[model samples]
Target: MNVAFTSRTLSLSRPQLFRGIRKVQSSFATCSVLSANRAVVYTSNGDPSQVLSALTFSNLPPPPPNTVNVRFLLSPINPADINVIEGVYPAKPNPNASLSSSGKGSQDEPVFVAGNEGLAEVTNVGDGVTHLQPNDWVIMTRQQAGTWSTGMNVKPQDILKVPRSLNDVEAATITVNPPTAYNMLHDFVQLNEGDWVIQNGANGAVGQVVIQIAAAKGLKTINLIRNRNDIASLTEYLSNLGATHVVTYDELSDKSFRQRVKEWTGGKNIRLGLNCVSGKPTTLMTRLLGQNAHLVSYGAMSKEPLSLPTSLFIFKNLTCHGFWQSRWYDSKSSGEREKLVETLVGLMRAGKLKEPSHEILTIQGSEGDEEASQKIRHAIATLAKGQHGKKILLKMEETF
Candidate 1:
């Protein structure tokens, strides 16, 4: 809500005063976020607990030509984001001092801001911008743009306008997990109504999205998750989200489970398998696939190498591949991205898709450096524990 108003003074001549008035009007007319901006910055690559800090930049300038000023509303704490901050991610952020308004940080070496995905609102626009206006909602189109901040200034094309009909959580999360599920489901196999697909880590964010998307496409999912104390509740949750079948890792080991899957699919071929948890879970999922079935591995949460029996490839003719949503996005054009978003938006509006359970961590906009750093540090610590099944989101704007 930080904004500036233009005022006229009588001490100046008509020509001078008029010129001054226009200058002030041009900067303030769009309702810019004129206060100091805050961000979570890191100077060196290491654990987030050791290197991350909060910084405030003062006297921020307005967006330049063809650019728009964006105030962040929500940013999700993805595991990949933590990896980026640790310098292990494949895509690294570019160092730029202009990200901070205050003349702080070394000119020779710059710092990096954290977070990858989030939702933002446009607060001001440059002269040549036409696609977006003040108060418009948007999401980052590219990764590694440093989303954990109060606000930022960028070109209009860098963000995609979000439909007002979608809520903060839905809009904030659609860029990653949902798209990963959608792409993996469509790109690897030609599935039809009632076609069965089996996947490990079915309780994870991507797995949940996979269930919903598969259901919307009239495909069935054999969802597998880790055995938790609240196994029944977790099973019910995925079932409510349209999972055709739900089983825990323990149940997956049961000798009768193969027969159960057979009865569930009515002996029909399960053409696709999605493996996120590697090691034994991946091998187990691969065994369930039918002839010439596709097995796509996207993540190795167990940090275990996939053990594939040669017999599956030689006898069953199983097709194995891997998927990374970031790579897919990098290879595609903006038009392709738009098409994917449009399709997901339609499904969401039609109630065929829904956001998974998530938790909101409110980061105060006015906290001091030490206070803000402590809050973020505690949040990161909590994230590392993975205590909750809900996705952790940084709710930046107070009103939200």
Candidate 2:
């Protein structure tokens, strides 16, 4: 076989190229064209740097019956997503034969795409589809749907259309952290207007959402965060988010802080406590709650066992429970999920809920796959280092 390779930069933009192709297709005698559907996939469970690579297919088949073809708009680099890629999370991706490459895979092995949540645009839909159409924005309704790609073919039942008014960052991140906050607040305890809720890790993604959502509901928050060099600015930021009181772990440790909290609450009972950081700080926070209070644990960033006084459990009758959003989705019906989406989106549209702060990492298509692959690798690297306190989002496509 004789092969020739040549490179040229076409001045035609994507829209212009599509128009030119449409015009030439009716006149040309013979033509061969293929669409490049590129994705990041891995074959084994390990570090993403060693396991992940860019895979491109020359052509994609049309959506089958009851399915839709979607192009991903933006996906987030969440810590849980990285854990899934590393094979340590409770949920794992199911491998598919569609990812098999001619030169990259063994005949018996399958591949998995990375990412759990994202926003996608419907480019095409098959027969019998009624809910979504071309240019409609949608988000994954289930976990482990593999969203880190330029495009995918998905089932209509697996996605829900989002409000068009939402910006890219807000829509991209809605499925995970925001829902977690919403569910945790409602599922564990019943809160009323002017009721007080105290939480640690108030600077985190879920924490931020909890603060905003609680405030919108006319509830008060006592936010606990770590002491940093810029504690003053951090306090101001959380206060602006509608926290009734902002205190550092150092302040939480002070023996005299209980009186201060008592004065801040003006004799009202703190009915609920949210603990994501389970350490001495949370141990101390439990002491501030009123009788019959509920303490819900979602995450443990400190990696330390929660130390609680035995008397508080016995005397105050405090209840401790754990919450996981993934489990909530698994046990709920489709209609329930739809209702939840509507509620959150409605809050967003009414200016009641705000998306957490984030930074964008564009991974646009270019002349070669190498550039796209490198951008993905760099984004994953940035995620590993914690993203400097900003949520990292991957902008997969340039258009739409």
Candidate number of the best TM-score: 1
Candidate 2 whole-model C-alpha lDDT, 0 to 1: 0.83
**Model 1, span 272-385: residue lDDT tens:** 999998999788778889988999999899989999999999999999989988899889998999899999999899998897688888766545567778888888877767
Q: In every candidate, how many clashes are there? A: 0, 0
Among these predictions, the greatest lDDT belongs to 1
Displacement of the residue 348 alpha carbon in candidate 2, Å: 0.7
Q: Look at candidate 2 and give me any clashing residue pairs.
A: none
Which 10-residue span in candidate 2 carries the lowest summed lDDT?
Answer: 1-10
Q: Give the per-residue lDDT of model 2 (tens digit) for 248-344.
A: 8988888999999888889888989999999888999999999899999988888899989999889999999988888999999999998999999
